[model samples]
Target: MRHHSTQIPESSKLSWMLLPTKKNTDTVQSTTDVLIKAGYIHQSQSGIYTLMPLAQRVVTKITQIITEEMERVGGQRMSMPSLLGPEAWKKTGRLESTGSELFTLTDRKGAQHILAPTHEEEVTSIVKSMVRSYRQYPLRLFQVTRKFRDETRPRAGLLRAREFIMKDMYSFDIDQQSAISTFHAVEQAYRACFDRLGVPYVVAEADSGNIGGELSKEFHFVSAAGEDTVLTCKCGYAANEERARGRGASGADMYEVEGSEQRVVVPAMRRPNLLKIKQAWPDCGELTLEHRKSGEEVASLGQMIALDEVCADGDYLVDAAVDGLAVEGIDNFSNVEVGDWHTAQSGDACCKCSTGTLESQTAIEVGHIFYLGDKYSKALDLLVQHDGKRQPVQMGCYGIGVSRVLQAAAECSSSSRGLRWPVSIAPYLATLVPLENNMEHATSVFATLSNICVNGARVFANNVIVDDRSYLSPGFKLHDAQLLGIPITVVLGQKFKQSGHVEVQLRVPRLEIATCVAGVDVTGDGYEYKAFVHVDQLAEFLVCALEGQF
Candidate 1:
């Protein structure tokens, strides 16, 4: 097999390469600063950015990885229009549900159009026109395109940008069971994609907001700067804090309290409405009630009974959080205490296991997968004939924030030096730098490396560059290389001058080297270098080293 060259030219000659210096700000450091300094992207507006050459290459590489994984899961790539009619959204009732986050506009003819934040309705409509029978079930269609949302405050660079790239896939099936199988398949594909990109992520049970689904999962990259709160238990149970739930101890104990004899009888339930209780006893001062076992003040007198003991005639309803509390019984209650009514919190006992305790962490949501059932299919009248009966198509939606992944990669990989991109998604694999006025030697070395084919293909033609800028000093060139976060840097000046050898440095930090290079030193924190290789063996050495063979 012949390998095609993917070599990029020197930065000095490329007019479009705009590597700007870092801007001064008092806030904490951000990946955007590294990106700006490395010439990857530039801010065009408050929440928009122009992907420069370097950024474009990185994004392209990430997209390629995603495309491969998506294809492996039988996803058929197609294009969807960014602008959609209001009727589709209105039919799904998302036009109002989406609130101000949706960007709406009117055309010259006074027809309302929305810059689609998602394509569920449109995709369902398109599939509806094509498939009318259950035989067309299990259809997986995907597209990579721009999505627009009118965010109230689009901050965090690409993470919360107003316009961003997204890969959305919709799966249509004959029933709920088939949709579930497709859902898991898509989930595994997502895992493969993120794994290939070297992103550290966690899959958490998430709330199905706006997308209206019975089950949803989110792939979140754990970072301190993340916007979502995640709760995890050692029992392997994890969930987004918004939808997280926990089991409570059985409410079986009760005690008598001395208060106004006027027993305010309310409904009985697992989690009683505390607000309604407060309204019923507004004049009642702090009613301090103690826990039945711990003797801690977990509830008040006016609060509903915490124990599961049913009131003979009347009892106050209280949440399970105050269960087993010593409280006076009230008369005349009807609601039964059934359901896990306690809100999950950090350090709470894990409901899934007997020993694990839940812990909380912040994470960024880069992708989401939802089992949408037949919500949209029913709303839009998307039905297919199954066994001579028409039924709504069971559907699922999966989305990856393509641009957010780029930023997330930077956030996860960057250090004090700069953006340390993983080799899989780096703009370029290696940077060829010459120390002194050594363009002649540098060019010769670059040309040889570019022509040396690996596996019957040019090794690094478009993927290698020579820092041929004569005006810039060696120190600046090296600094720029580090800032750009190229994984490998090869120098052909001093070492080659003294001996017929080229110096190669693996720029990945010691901790990260293990992720990119297999048998490298993982004990320290900084860049590592291999002994100089003879000039003639430089290309082969680099190819093998990058492939982690050496």
Candidate 2:
């Protein structure tokens, strides 16, 4: 078995590519190109990746965001073993419930063990043994490490896979209110982490798969291709399939077709067909309906539009002039589509800005945070002594899709040429390519670029590749740079050799590039070549440019 080195060089490049003596050299090179060019994931074996320097750096950066937010939101870090004793899982009935998802094995002692798909049982058992009082009422613990799941289909790159990194955090509270508070804190942290990652996301209601819980939510970056479908309401409510609500029951009262108003129905419609209903009653005042079965009533009218005037009053319902008026109840809340009016529209509550409409886009769900009531604690009998009585502790769990994030980055940032990475997630900040075989000039240019990169690195944000092969051509190098998606590339060629400056290209464009060199140079080449910038400055420039686009 061949094991690749896990040591990340300070220079952040692979010292050597590992290959079995039997594998063809050309095949290995091809594989390397496919992995590096597509993004910064290099396979060390058939199923494992080496996480080339650039990819590794992005992973680390993402992890830092997770850590910072977790800490800020009251999650204490704890390192749980990748290999957990099967007995602990069996204690919670998970060994029987999650059979195949668990990676089971036997040690030399013939004792059974299972890789932890999650740490709920382990964390609960530990807390049960250590805590026996109310003082430790709201305890939160977490771990950032690799997790294993025997996935059935590992496709769409790392979006779904067998083994990957994860940050799982567990919280314990004596009361439901405290546990809910802790849960909201972690949820806020998750939002912050995604924000830092430069990805747009929403806290959608999600099913607690395997991890049985009452009130659970998934933080989804909505995408058409995303695995989980999130349904959001124009009223600012959003949830995954597990927690999404359908159209509820509206009152039996009919409305005038010619009037205008928006009404809130109790037991909201699951599959609201506004168009179908609108066609039925085109002039009805904004109406509210309720499901007869649910028996839930509206507490207060949220927002109502009476014709052209926007009013916040609830008692004003004009008499309907149409005899065919009827209230409908829908039962399917599957997913939100591009044109779904059931979803939040413009002028709705914004997650960040107050002015913009509540827009929805696609994003892969790489992580989730949930507040698990005593569902597991009561099931597993992991109770603690508090206030002279033993009671089940409220729990919460937070997870980060260590591997899915990598794939999401690729999916969002790739272009026709190849996978261009955001500098924040790029394996290398920049790739130094010398266009021709002018060894002397290439070496000199490499040194100059290396010096600038080192300066950036000192500030905790810089990377570069010094081209030493001296074999590839300018066009080839340019193609490879675009393919790799590095934010910046420095070209050293016959032209650069003739002048003191290098032709720096920014892989990711920004307004600053256009502004910095605005009116500086222009030629009617039929293509809008905006500006010139140094490779070292590209990362910072792009960072500033893309601050809010996500």
lDDT of each: 0.71, 0.56
How much lDDT does candidate 2 score? Answer: 0.56
Q: Per-residue error at 342 for model 1, in Å?
A: 3.7
For all the candidates, what are their Cα RMSDs to the real structure?
A: 7.5, 10.5
Q: What TM-scores do the predictions have?
A: 0.80, 0.68
What lDDT tens digits, residue by residue, belong to model 2 across residues 1-550?
Answer: 2223233222533223221212123432332344544446755544456675556767887787788888886777878787888776776678897988778899999988888778888888788788766787678788888888887665555666677888899998888888898888777778878876765567776667677676677766555557665656555667554334342122222222224323322212233334334433455444433223221121122223112111111322122111223312221111211122232232334433343334344557888777889877887787877668787888888888866786676665554456656555566656666665554554444444445422334322345654443344556556666666666666666655564445565555221333433222422222112233343444444344334333
Per-residue lDDT of 214 in model 1: 82
Q: Mark the regions of model 1 whose C-alpha exceeds 4 Å error after superposition.
A: 1-16, 21-28, 246-333, 447-461, 509-531, 537-550
Candidate 1, residues 1-550, lDDT tens digits: the string is: 2212333353422222455543434443777866766777788998898888888888898899889999998999999999999897888899998989998899999998999889999999998888866776789999999999888898888999999999999999988888899999999999888877776788898878789788889999888879998889977898887666554333333323346322221123223323333433455433323234322332322344323223222333333223444334333222223333224567766767888888998889999999999999999999978878788999999999999999988887787777787777888777788875565576667777667666766636577766655556777777887778877777776768887677676665332333333322223345555446677776656566556311
Worst 10 residues of 2 by lDDT: 304-313
**What C-alpha lDDT does candidate 1 achieve relative to the native structure?**
0.71
lDDT at residue 179 of model 1 (Cα atoms): 89
User: What TM-score does model 1 achieve against the real structure?
Assistant: 0.80
